[model samples]
Target: MTHAFYVYASYGFAALVTIVVTVWTWADGRARRRELAALEAAGIRRRSARPKDSLGDGE
Candidate 1:
């Protein structure tokens, strides 16, 4: 019912959102890395990972 209560509640909600997003991003990155590793193990590679000379761009 007071201004201070509203402010504190808003700040708490923002903090909670920030922490959730941070954890979600971290977990997604780990999952993507694992997927990339699996793909590499299956003989798939990112084009950028190839040697520049192998691209045959007349280096």
Candidate 2:
């Protein structure tokens, strides 16, 4: 019964990390999609990193 503090803290920390990663991934995907859409609308027709090019080319 005396370990309730640790248990509560662990649960709180787990929730915080979960919330953080969820938000981070969501924001990242949304931003990338928006940028891609804008680029398409602007007629770039290509991502900064072309699929044909290797990752070493640059992001």
Candidate 3:
């Protein structure tokens, strides 16, 4: 096998891996958002979403 073949194959594999990871991350984010929405609809809330006054933090 030639050096050029190896280099191109390596680059192709790297690009394929990058694309796969990007797609997976995007999909996972969408799923998480959906779950969060469902939880919010069920009256569960995130602490960060609450008003600071409700947290009893000293000003």
Candidate 4:
């Protein structure tokens, strides 16, 4: 194979990998957001929503 063929193949492979990762991340994020929304709708609250203790020590 020619040097040009190898270079183009590598570039194409990299691009394909990047696209796959980006799409996977986007879809995962959407799924997580939907799950969170459903949980909230079911009346579940995050830990951060609760009031903290006055003491500086960690509880």
lDDT of all predictions, in order shown?
Answer: 0.96, 0.87, 0.95, 0.91
lDDT of 3 by residue, 1-59 (tens): 99999999999999999999999999999999999999999999998899867877653
User: Which 10 successive residues of model 3 have the least lDDT summed?
Assistant: 50-59
What are the per-residue Cα lDDT tens digits for candidate 2 across 1-59?
A: 56998999999999999999999999999999999999889888765456665656655
Task: After superposing candidate 2 on the true structure, give the runs of residues whose Cα lies further than 4 Å from its correct spot.
Answer: 47-59
Q: Write the per-residue lDDT of candidate 1 for residues 1-59, one digit (tens) a residue.
A: 99999999999999999999999999999999999999999999998899867988764
Better of 1 and 3 by TM-score: 3
For candidate 4, report its TM-score. Answer: 0.83
Model 1 lDDT vs. the true structure? 0.96
lDDT of 3: 0.95
Can you give the TM-score per candidate against the true fold?
0.88, 0.69, 0.89, 0.83
Return whichever of 3 and 4 wins on lDDT. 3
- TM for candidate 3 is 0.89
State in Å the error of residue 45, model 4. Answer: 0.9
Q: lDDT: which is higher, 2 or 4?
A: 4
Candidate 4 residue-wise lDDT, 1-59, digit = tens: 99999999999999999999999999999999999999999999787776577445675
C-alpha root-mean-square deviation, candidate 2: 5.5
For model 2, what is the C-alpha lDDT against the true structure?
A: 0.87
Q: Is candidate 1 or candidate 2 better by lDDT?
A: 1
Question: Which pairs clash inside model 1?
Answer: none
